[model samples]
Target: MSRGAWRDRGAWLLAFMHAFVAVCVLLPSAGVHAAETVHAQIAATSEQVAALTAVLEARLEPLVLEVTAVEAVDPAAALSAPPTEDVARVWITLDDGGATAIVLSGDGARGMVRQLPREGASDEVLREELALVIGTAVDTLRRDAASLASSAALREELGLSPEPEPPPEPAPSVEPPPPAPPEPSPIASLPPLPPVVRTPPPVEPTRWRLAGMAFYEVQGFAAGQIIAHGPGLSLGLGGPPLTLGPRFELSGQYRLPAAAENDVAGLRLHSGAFRLTTQLTVVRSSRVLLRVLGGAGLDLLVIEPFLVDARAELMPRRVRIAPALRFGLDVPVRLAGEVSLRIGAGMDVDAIGTRYVIQDGDALVPLLDPLRIRPLLSLGVDTTFVGHPAFGP
Candidate 1:
């Protein structure tokens, strides 16, 4: 296009743009004015309602109001017009029985009971309710006063009653139990005797005893040439006492040898014996006693040789007897405790030859010379099921 024509069109477009800007700016101011006018109207209505509410309240109870104003810079100041208003309302209903009072403002939209009526059904009903409440209060007060009066009367009566007398206690008395019959002495009941009581008089107590021992021995002339004399268990018994008021007892004992003799080279001598004994119990107490024992017995000895070549042989299966003596103490910790432990030591004097003899190499030799006089010591625990209180009557 030509420059002149283009310039003319540009100018026309500029003019139209300026007109649009002007319209946009003016339209906002118009709308703001309209909104401010509406708000002012709302404010006026709120004030009128508040005023009317105050009037209703005053009629119900008394009230008052004061108003004042000030000025400030505002764009709406130029557009300000006279204050516009409309009336606001409130309603109240009061019923005393059925005839409700109807005091109201001119529009019937607002009112109050500034004053109540005198005497109708509603008035009488209200008075009656009030009377009923008052009567209940008066009745409660009368009951409280009557209770106080009754308490005072009770106090006066109690003060007039006589006091009671105290009770008396009885005296104690003494009485003796009837005398028991006397028991007759045993001698009074016996017939005339001829010097002695005979029938062996009476035995004070029965007696019992035990005797035994154990031994281990190895004999050899040099090292690695020893033999085991196998271990043995033996026991002896003493019977009841004899004449002279418990002087003697009959006793016996037996022993057996064990099977394994550790000796690997020479003869292993294992011995067993039995003896008959007599004992005397020396009376010590109703439940305790001491005793001395004497006895004689027989024994059997077996000699076995287990050679280094694994061969074994048995020699002289012999029988023999010997005598022994025993002395010991018996202690009873408690008469009826059911348990007792006795400890004793004694000696056995054996006449060596009667037992066994062997041919060692060339000459005859006593196999077990019986040790002549061997000492015996032992401890034993015994239970007397018959004598203990738990077992006795």
Candidate 2:
């Protein structure tokens, strides 16, 4: 072929890929994993993947697109796509008309939606088509990457390990043995069949319905002269993918052995807090869910003191609302229906870093100066409410 012929072929190829991938880019957003559905799986050889990836990146770079590569396999068995596509998958399906490039998009929302198939494609041609699929995924990723960057659950859900299924084992070859004496005196009747039972799949629940969350947390406070550890109880409400919206929580904590003077000093510390939090799901699957959360809270802390000596004297205890910021990881195991057992681990940082206050005469002083970040791990239950709560008409 002449230089002009090659140039024409290249131009046509580019135009064809652009048209093919354009369909994927324009599809409607379905689940919250709209962008992730495009995070893809491909069926091809390692060599084919390398060649395809190079071509895709070369073309996608000008458009500033990025895509992750799942491991490639032998192209011979790359025709049938995976059984389920939690994320989009790309492969070539065969018909009478040679090879057809297909992209199965959506996370079950649009179940195995096929892209515009290309016909009579070669290795080079198929590479171009697969690259186009990733390019389309990159387009939507731009819209969600910022919000998803902080979500570890979303990243884990997109775990694109496209390990090729092992090929079917070949049947063993056998030789017939010589038969001796054959005696027949048996009934030809077959045994009765077992009863057939049908199990319907559970209705998939939407994540953010009105969800209630409860958990136990252990809070710690320590500094120079003060060392305190306390158990806390937390309850929260919010929903519609309970992990996406703001949840209001009320929690209370208590620790013993506080310092007090003059007559009474049993030294017990009590604290209550109201927190507003939002959780970002990093990954959500059939059996488990992972999330990262951020929130702000005000702690209403009260101190009770016990005097060691009979002659000790001091004013009343002090109460204050210390502001704090908290970060957490919530991992839940999805139970049967709309219920989940949640295990949460969190850390709280006091904004002002001041320690617990003690009563000295009529003034409040730092009993545990320079407070530290509190760490807690909790087990809880989460459930979604039936109807949306309605405020006034």
Candidate 3:
């Protein structure tokens, strides 16, 4: 309410406004000075540029260094430009010989040239080496700038005149030394060593092979008009093939009994066989094998009759054995590892013929006629193992 009090309030407000305006104007300039910037100009292939930039950034991450990629018409001109206090410029160039890196800071320009390794090296390795060189140069520039700042501050504190120092003259480029000549052989003056004796590798002795197979077989008896099919197992032992002779295998097979029935008389015919065979390998390769087989065996046949008519009299079951001769061709294809799929077709000739019949009242109805020839088909898996002879070296 008093005049002196109002005048005092106005003066205080004016002073506060002037201070706020000063702070607003100076704060941004201080922030801009505090933040340092690094610009990188790469003059190399695209692959080199990408590799160098990524590795350089990773190496400088601990320093919170920010790298900005820039394109320059002349990298030399960029490197030679006047340096700023808060900014650094790096120029990297790749050539056939190696890489060259130049860094410019407040202190001046620093450069490094690295030669490629004499031995052939990959582009990735070369990029890493060049990136390391550039990183070292940048670190040196930072140290020099920090040292100059400290020296200037110390001089101002001592109240001495802050005199500017001229930039140091650039050092003359030095060429890399030429490669040294190869050393002379120590044994050059001595008589030539005895001709190196080379021995031939020993030949591997032949080994016997044991083979086994489990199969499902189908046999058609055309003469008797019956089909019999069942599972069979076989085992064989064979020697390796000779240069001019076929490989031989002696095998034995036993087929389980399988049955076929006649619809009219309800007569069931069951048959099985046991055979001894000798197989000769005609063609054998890694992928496929062919063999011709011949053998002799015994065939067993059984017959049973069931009649539905009340007056029909069924004959008792009968079993018969007949000698047989077998001839076949087998082909085995390798599936994987030591396993093979075997397929065979064969024929059997019976030595004796026997007939089967059923009795109904006064009628004698034939069930199966004598079987003279039977054709056979088979599919199986085969495996073999090789072993050295028991008594031979």
Candidate 4:
């Protein structure tokens, strides 16, 4: 046996044994003597597909490769350009007896079906055989992904549907009638009640959103003074943009200056935090979206002192990490294309000791104290993606 085959023997044996049990459970016997050949062929095809999928995902990414059911695929999909498209099509088939075929007709390669060893073949043997079978097709897919990483393509390629065209604007809202005058006679009348107006519910937003922002430190209780502004960003990475669904988010903020109170330590502070959060859609409608979110992650603070003694030496540059919890709102209004205007807010609290830093000559000393919760306010632009792969050209 070759070195490559020998190396894969253990993993192949283990996977093959598991595959055998799965195949047996899925493919019942017609008779005690012999199992159906087509069932075995189906099992064979499944194993090969699984192998291909594993390799591709490890080398490329889930966004770069998509697995689909035969029925879900359109007959015309073969004509779409994979390099510029979200998905590519290739075929794998197993024959009734001792043969298998790999068809690379659609994804920018020659339209030919190549044969390989039959089902139940050992992994050691199949590895060598299958490499020759699908190697070129894998290469083609890798090239396509690399070429289109940063292209201005629509998000529909990743199985996402385009947003429907917007409806025409609604008629202007009518004002409620004014309240009637109070009774002139000696009596029975308190001040007339004002007319009531019912407001519309918040709208839900469809599609993934990406945003970059600048923060205004509305309140920083621990620092005792208003923190100077900072920079932040958010990503709507939850699975899909469906209604009332829970979505995952990865977000971050960096406040460049969290100036210490009273300058007691002759030191100032800089803080940054990273979080993974979930946002649940409360409403989505024409031109508006509302979501409520909560998240927890790492908060980092750096203490730097003002060193101004000719050489201006400040000692003991210190840093600390705290557990942070955040809850917030993300409301965005639709603009042209995939862009939106965002007005968002959050409450962030960190569990950290507010250690005071003071200068004793060139050495900096510290005294431990408690910290407080911070409120963050931001205004920024957000954009929806057509399944932007995490890594792109």
Worst 10 residues of 3 by lDDT: 242-251
Off by over 4 Å in 4: 1-224, 261-264, 307-315, 357-371, 387-393
TM-score of 4: 0.39
Model 1: per-residue Cα lDDT over 285-389, one tens digit each: 444545565656554556564443354334534333343333333332223454444444565555543333444458554433344455565444444422112
Look at candidate 4 and tell me the lDDT of residue 119.
73
Instruction: List lDDT for all candidates, in order.
Output: 0.37, 0.54, 0.66, 0.54
Error of 3 at 25 (Å): 99
Best by lDDT: 3
List ranges where model 2 is wrong by over 4 Å. Answer: 1-208, 223-266, 356-366, 387-393
**Clash number for every model?**
6, 21, 0, 10
Steric clash count of candidate 2:
21
Candidate 3 regions exceeding 4 Å error are 1-203, 222-225, 242-265, 359-364, 388-393
Better of 1 and 3 by lDDT: 3
Model 1 scores a TM of 0.30
Ranking by TM-score: 3, 4, 2, 1
On TM-score, the leading prediction is 3
For 1-393, candidate 2 gives per-residue lDDT tens digits of 899999999999999999878766666333324334333334445665467657855755544223344444323333234344334444433233333343333322121222334465576765666556555654444444332222223223334334455899998988778886787637547676898898999876543335565655555555444444445555555454433444445555544444422233345556665666676656756678777888887877786665566665644777777899988887878775657788888888889876545465788655445356877677777665653321111
